[model samples]
Target chain A: MEVLGIILAGVLVNNFVFMQYLGICPFLGVSKDFDMATGMSGAVIFVITVASTVTAALEQYVLKPLELEYLRTIVYILVIASFVQLVEIFMKKTLPGLYQALGIYLPLITTNCAVLGAAMLNVTKSYGVVLSTVSGFAGALGWSLAIIIFAGIRERWKLMDIPATLDGFPLALISTGLMSLAFLGFSGLFSNLVK
Target chain B: MGDRLLVTPSPHVKSTKTVQGIMLDVVIALCPAAIAGTVLFGFRSALIILVSVASAVASEALYQKAVKRQVSINDFSAVITGLLLALTLPPHVPLWIPAIGAAFAIVLVKQVFGGLGNNFLNPALAARAFLLAAWPLHMTQDWVNPMTYDAATSATPLAGFNATGQTAFTLKQMLLGQRPGSIGETCILALLLGGLYLIVRDIIDYRIPLGYLGTLAIGTWIFGKPGAFFQGDPLGAIFLGGAFIGAFFMATDYVTSPVTPRGRLYMGIGCGLITLVIRLWGGYPEGVTYAILFMNLVTPLIDKYVVPRYYGSGHDKMARKGGR
Candidate 1:
């Protein structure tokens, strides 16, 4: 039940992309096509889940005991960056198909705020290691959900008769606004279930 | 008359309507509300509208000339945008507010994005949102009394209702535009006349207005007042704030709204739901502009998913599965 609450909170109630406005670069950049969006989402989910578990363990055992909390940001980024690198090399060796599908996005996950944000959020919220790990996986899934759905909707505009000026980024931003509005419906969803 | 054989592509049957004609009708439709606003708020309101309109037209022409694009001011779309921007403003804001807002609307929101037909968000509402964010005090707390035209810091009816579950004005006064609010949004009757003219002329789709008002009325009736669900006043919710103008004018904008009939209906409902959510629970007293703007963003999504069935593309599984 607690894990369920954590997942719900991370995905719907506290969405990293639409609500927290994190990882917007990848969300917008890779979202123009459906396959790319799914590939990016899969890579983010893998990295985020692993990075969250490792960061939780480090914070609990190393940083907390040493009282080196001020080094949180740098440590978190270093941890997430190394984690993404490991995933990239591992995926290239073992899962060549996915590696090719994700292309540069797998490496770009190091700079994604959502990964670091998940780790930092674990510290700020003082969540336990298990819950923090749960949150990381959920947040990445939430982001994937948004990007995939957005990509599918974007394909519909391929043959649309649009105005000359609203062709690209402007239209995308507006579409994002509406998606965010739809997400707003979930604002109080976890209030009853989660503390 | 010398006869010349002409070879033209599709759309060989052309209507008498042009961009200029449609925009002129919009301007004419807006006159009742504009005139009412001026009569109710004194000459300062009129001056502000003029300044906003002038700034919008000048900005468009200047930007086009600067960018070496053909100056399309003859289409009258800029005039309508300027007029719409002016209507949404508070009557007592400094002249420079409208001027700056008009410039931002034209240059940033409309022209930079491509031009009149291309802007994703409604230029006037986008500018209004910008002004609101930039000058919250001027936007929210600067309402003048309707007839007296004095600078009174009284809360609008929506604000008061949000706080106390009751408003100072009766239904008649709310409908008649005898209230302290934005210049053009106060008068429900004027807005309705304008809306009716557009609908009758077939210039605007009726589904959007119907869907928006119907959803809003139902939502408010169910959950308008805080604690007293289903006992809430629906009429007041529809009449007050910018709901009337937003539903009729802003949400019904062709470029910003969905092209298909079903998509348009969904847009209306979406706007209504968001507006109700904001008015009832969100921090803002008015939600019309943001609601419409948000719906404008969703227009493409709506158009995609709610695609009308192609004629005679009957029982084709591949066609049905294509959206996935």
Candidate 2:
């Protein structure tokens, strides 16, 4: 039940893109098409999930015992970077099909704030390893859901007669605003349901 | 005489109205509210309006000149944007506030995207939202007492009504614009005249205003009172705040609103529903600007689904048969 609540909270109530305003770069950049958005989302889900588990374990075993908690930011970022590099190599060696699917976006995910944010947030919330993994996977899933829906909307948006000045980023930003407004409905969902 | 017909290309239909003509009509319509706002408040109100309009026009011209594009300053669109932004500001805001708002509207919101016909959101309202976020205290606490022009910090009718479920002003004062609120939003008669003139001159469609105001009235009447249901002051809800101006001017913007008639009606109703929700239950005392801007974002979707039946498609019959 707790895991269910965390997943629900992560996917809907605390969506990384529309709700928390995280990972906006890729949210806007790769959201113009559907297939690319899917690939990007898949890569993110794997990396964030792995990165969260490792960072949580490291904080529990290393930082807490040494009382070097303040260095957690630097440690977590370094772990995430190295972990993504390892994933890239492993995917290329054994799972080349999946590696090519993610292509350039795999490298881009290293800098994505959502990944770093998930790692840091797991530590901040002091989640156990199990909850950390669940929250990270759920956060990435929430991002996938948002990007997919936005991609569908933009696909249809292409045919509409948009004004010249609003053809690109301006229109995209307004669309994000409306999407955020819709996501605002999810606020307090977990709290209301838990009671 | 040789009787040869002139076979022109597509778009054979032509109209006498130009973009400048439409924008000029809007400017003329806004005159009554501008005059009334200045009269009710002091010279500061007039100065704010002038600075706002001038900055908007100047920004557009300067941006175009800098970018080496043909300057379209002759069209009064920037002036209209400036006027709309000024009307939404508090009467006592510093002169720089409107100037900054105008520059943001014209340069960033409108010109950056392309220009007049290209902006996705209502430039004036977006800039107002930006200003509100940047300086909430100045925007909310700078309301001057009407007529006296005293630097009063009294809450507006909507604010008081939302907080205590009551208001000090009566129906007559509300109608006659004797309240402390945004400069142009206070006067119903002036805004009505401008809105009516636009409708009469065929500058704007009537369905948007009617649908927006009607939905707001119904929604507020149904759920306005805090605890008691169906016991809310619908009239006061409609008259107070920026609803009157928003419904008529900002929401009816040509570039941001839907092109089809029915789609525009839906836009209006959607805006009204959002506005009521925000006003009655949300944290804000007013929701006109955000409501309209939100609906503006949805305009494209409305246009997509609410398309008029093609002239001779007859696909409706096949679709019905397939459904069965």
Please name the candidate that would achieve the greatest TM-score relative to the true structure.
1
Tens digit of per-residue lDDT, candidate 2, span B184-269: 99888999999999999988889898989999988887777778777777778788899999999999998788878799899889
Q: Assess candidate 2 and give its TM-score to the true structure.
A: 0.74
Return the TM-score for candidate 1, rounded to 2 decimals.
0.81
Return the clash pairs for model 2, or none.
Answer: A165-B113, A165-B114
B1-324 per-residue lDDT for model 1 (tens digits): 001111112335565766677888999999999999999999999999999999999999999899778898888888988999999998999999999999988887777655765556788998888787779899888889999999877777787675555666788898889998889989999999999999999889999999999999899888877787887778888887888999999999887788777888999999999888777766577788878877876665676578776756675867787865
Candidates in order, TM-scores: namely 0.81, 0.74
Query: Where is the poorest 10-residue window by lDDT in model 1 chain B?
Result: B1-10
Off by over 4 Å in 2: A1-21, A34-111, A122-195, B1-14, B313-315, B318-324
> What is the C-alpha local distance difference test score of candidate 2?
0.82
lDDT of 2 at B40: 86
Tell me the docking grade of candidate 1: incorrect
